[model samples]
Target chain A: MLYLEWVSFLGLLGCGLWIFLKLPIEASQGFPQKIMYLHVPSVITTYLAFFVVFIFSIAYLWKRELVFDQIAKASAEVGLVFCALVLLTGAIWGKPTWGTYWVWDARLTTTLLLFLIFMGYFLLRMSVNDRDKEARLASVLGIIGFLDIPIIHKSVEWWRTLHQPSTLFKVESGQASPSISPELYYPLVASIIVMLVFYIYLLLLRYQTEKRTDRLNQLLADTQD
Target chain B: MKTRTKFVIGGAIIFAVLTALSVQGLQEMTVFFYTPQEVLASPGKFENKTIRIGALVQKGSVEWNAQAIQLSFNITEDGKKFIPVYYAGVKPDLFREGQGVVVEGKMQGPRFEAHQLLVKHSEEYTVETENKKNKEDYYKSIQAQ
Candidate 1:
């Protein structure tokens, strides 16, 4: 699973870099500003993966299915990791462009909050002993907590904030502007597809690991009985 | 009207409220930038509005008043354009002339008043990641042979 996951992730990463490098020099902003593609897409994908967790959480609550719970937990775990990457990359980009790696503005603050919520979600899961009860609690929290993701995403615009306005996928342009020439856009889209493939592949591996752990736990209980 | 249905409806309401809050947040996340040339050409577009200006420090424009701990410099996107900036704050360690920089503040009167100035530096420090460093060292040894 590790090797397989790496292959898919690396391939996607390679494709993304290729597309990013191919962008015309005359595009909106020049070379150094290119980090936007990497940082923005990771943030977008983090939300997407966590939204999957929210849906699985709902399914787990409704049907009490262990499979749904597994999916929810796995997705949240991966989402948190991706969210961390978003912060790290954003900070890296921020330092050069914004002059500081951090600001307590709307976008940054809300992203930090979302990071904390996901951290709390994992901590809550660990503190529980009963498998079924843990799933029920986590499912409820996962479904509720994911509400913050979209809020963090849009906080910059809703308030008077010190963040940049959305440029990619703007209503004014059906696609990325000439600012993001096909050179960059193609790689960006490629990176996203690669990320999705890698994410799903990881989710399945983690779900299987959880199932095996549960089976081992059941075996121990039976032995005691 | 089962107990479970009520609980589900209550959960959905909570979800709706939180989603609305998040949507509002997502709308305001990015910061806009403008080069000195852009700001100068359409000062009207950016008039009285908070903005960031990017430029190189003009050759003879820097004036640091030690008493006030303020640093002043003229910036221009290109040599042909220039804007005077007055910043009264502790400058970043790497602040110097002929360097690229971004200043966040607003234009006031004839000067671009800066509330905050962050200096950018290239990454020269290396992280000691064991595997990466080790591999590079190994290749170097092979080349030496």
Candidate 2:
């Protein structure tokens, strides 16, 4: 786990160097376009983290297990942070390229909606006291919240948007070819892979803390009894 | 009982906020901007109504007044039909001829009065060999500034 953290961190640093020092300036956006390295990967990671939550939440609901719920909660917390990262990096990129930091366009708005939904997921977790009740309700909300990802992902295509459509996910005649040139595309893929590694490391670390806290709470409750 | 009330209130608030935001988002998502064809076809409908028009900046139709700090350009979805827009703001960094833009304002008697101008970029990324020459000129423009 420790090595995983270091590897992701160094991998990101290497990607940053590659973006700035080696990559050619984009034809239209030039220098500020480099922020895509940060923005796109965070977007991908946020999607993946919540996806983890969605899967485990379903698992918890079906199996009625604390471990599944623990995993769901852990991923949701990490996903929330990554979702925030997505918003922040998006705003930073938007200002330089789109001439504004924020817009109420569908793609941007739905992404914000995802962030708020998960924030409420945490708040919902805190509002309930009974462990089973909390897990049950939170899992339901987790599943509902994850459905928004597909909507967010397709917003650019489904409606009018100031934000551009997916660069990497662009399908050409049923083939998976990204819209980016080869020189820039490879590093973007590298960053997304590194970001996923970092996400795994964080999820494991947070899951440990969640498990310990649950055990400590049980111990305290027994002592009080 | 106390936690129940707290939970109800918190949940209600979250639901309310989410509903309100999505309603707004739905509006924007549905029609972030209308096309020139739509706006131009029913000129009376968009007139005096504050709305957005998204289209490409018509080639050779941009006029920027440095002293007045005003920009005027024609936007067109097709080659034949064009809508003239007047914007009283500094040109956006990405603003260029043939670039896509969304202008927010109302339609005047003849021209569109725009208060905000946003450049819409494309998803495709490409590197051109001739861009090298443009990059040098771009650097010169920045250094000169």
Candidate 3:
């Protein structure tokens, strides 16, 4: 697993660099639009990570298995990192495009709320001493936090926001169509694939570390007895 | 009932209630931005409600007073339907005639009283040759004037 992770990581880095240097600059956004390749993929990966957390949280609660809990915790941690990257790249893009670094638009506000809710989930875990109780509470929070995903996805359509609607999945006049030009679409797809593979690699590494920690704790508990 | 069954049912109930509330909130909170044609077509429906309208700035319609900090322009769609806008605020640097803009304000009779104005710019990068020619032409036009 470690060997595979390093190989994929190197491949992702190479692909990312190639796309950055070779992709054609958009006519309107010029250089700033390049941030989209990073920003969009980060947000997509964040959503995927949270979805993993949601599923594993439900599994943990249903089966009362420590492995499921470990996976949920690991995914949440990774999701939070990607969510923060989304915000950072978004802010960088916003400064040049919108003439402001931030706005209280519905989409932006909901995304921030999503980030905060997960932060609360982590805080709740740290405050609890009992392992089972902590898992139960965090799983519940994780399930509730997943609700924000749909809200964030539809915020642009649901409210008047400074943020533009999705370019890839445009639903204008009740018709869904992709609006991206071919020149921009291919590189974006490549970037998203690279980011997603990297996300999976990180998730596997985090899960392995979590399993090791759990084993160490069990050994220590047995020795104390 | 078993605790596991209870938790599953309770989680489902909470999820349902939250989804319902979100749908209700979205209905009330959604303020759709309209074009000039849409607003003009249904003037009575949007009266006094804060709404956003986007269109191209009509050429030669801009009136900016730096000292008074007042800006006014006519926004047009299809170059036929025009909505006059009056705004008292700091205009964005990109505010110019023949550019796309979206203004948020309430409609008062035939005019839009704007609270905020956002300049909508394209994502395309200007080519170097075009940029140089534009600069030269701008200077030449100013000298001619």
TM-scores for all candidates: the values are 0.65, 0.89, 0.76
Docking class of 1: incorrect
Question: Which runs of model 2 end up more than 4 angstroms from their true locations?
Answer: B1-25, B129-145
List the candidate 3 regions with Cα displacement exceeding 4 Å. A171-177, B1-29, B32-56, B59-71, B76-81, B86-100, B104-115, B120-145
Cα lDDT over the full model 1: 0.70
Which ten contiguous residues of candidate 1 chain B have the minimum total lDDT? B136-145
lDDT by residue (A1-225, candidate 2, tens digit) is 899989988988998888888998888888888888888989988899999999999999789999999999999999999899889988988987888999998888889989998998999999999888999889979987998999999877777788877889987679987878899899999999999999999999999999999999899999999
Please report the TM-score between candidate 2 and the true structure.
0.89
User: In model 3, which residue pairs have backbone atoms overlapping below 3 Å?
Assistant: A27-B124, A27-B125, A28-B123, A28-B124, A28-B125, A29-B123, A29-B124
Whose TM-score is greatest here? Answer: 2
What local lDDT score does residue B5 receive in model 2, on the 0 to 100 scale?
74
TM-score of chain A of each: 0.88, 0.98, 0.95
Candidate ranking (lDDT, best to worst): 2, 3, 1
Please list the Cα RMSD from the true structure of every candidate, rounded to 1 decimal place: 12.1, 6.6, 7.4
Please compute DockQ, using alpha carbons, for every candidate against the native two-chain complex. 0.07, 0.36, 0.16
Clashes of 2: 0
By TM-score, highest first, what's the ranking? 2, 3, 1
Q: Against the correct fold, how does model 1 do in TM-score?
A: 0.65
| CAPRI level of candidate 2 | acceptable
Ranking by DockQ, best first?
2, 3, 1
Single out the weakest 10-residue window by summed lDDT for candidate 3 chain A: A156-165
Top candidate by lDDT: 2
